[model samples]
Target: AQSVTQPDIHITVSEGASLELRCNYSYGATPYLFWYVQSPGQGLQLLLKYFSGDTLVQGIKGFEAEFKRSQSSFNLRKPSVHWSDAAEYFCAVKLVRGSTLGRLYFGRGTQLTVWP
Candidate 1:
């Protein structure tokens, strides 16, 4: 069984400041990892994913993440934050094996608040 955990239930950052959201996962083997953001009354949009290769992966909206196997973590980072970036962020994981969409799981949810 694969699972994802996001420690922070909410985070507040000033506009134009750096931000980082923590994420951890539990899986038997290398799993597909993702960071998604959802605005109020909107759908989740893929921020990034780790399938293979380089640990560092770039995502939309100037976001990026690093896959740390030892720590079982894939944390999201953005050097500068914006008012528009304030939203809910979710960490999700799925088996690298194909046809396992049913195994995908998401975190409780992390609300990001940005102050101007």
Candidate 2:
């Protein structure tokens, strides 16, 4: 079964600090990787995605993710943290070939706290 794992359920960082949310997936073949941010009382927003071609993909809001096939990981990173950046981050994976194609398998989610 394909699944996404986010090791840290909650992380706290000071404003202007660097942020990294770990994500790992389990799949036979390389599947699509995505990072989504869900602010309080808001819907999920696409932060970045890795479909193919590039190992490192840039996303919205100064976010980026590197796809490492050897580790089956697609971790999201940011150079600086902002108060507004505090939100719940979720890592998702989608299979290319299967009955569940196009269905996103999401991680449990990581709650980020930014302190000023």
RMSD each, Å: 1.4, 1.8
lDDT, candidates in the order shown? 0.92, 0.94
Candidate 1 per-residue lDDT, tens place, 1-116, comes to 65688999999999999999999988877788899999999999999999899999999999999999999999999999999999999999887556755466899879999999
User: How high is the lDDT of residue 29 in model 1?
Assistant: 78
**Poorly placed runs, candidate 2 (over 4 Å):** 97-101
- On lDDT, the leading prediction is 2
**Per-prediction TM-score, please?**
0.93, 0.94
Off by over 4 Å in 1: 100-102
The model with the greatest TM-score is 2
At residue 93, what lDDT does model 2 achieve? 90
Clash tally, candidates in order: 0, 0
lDDT of 1 at 101: 50
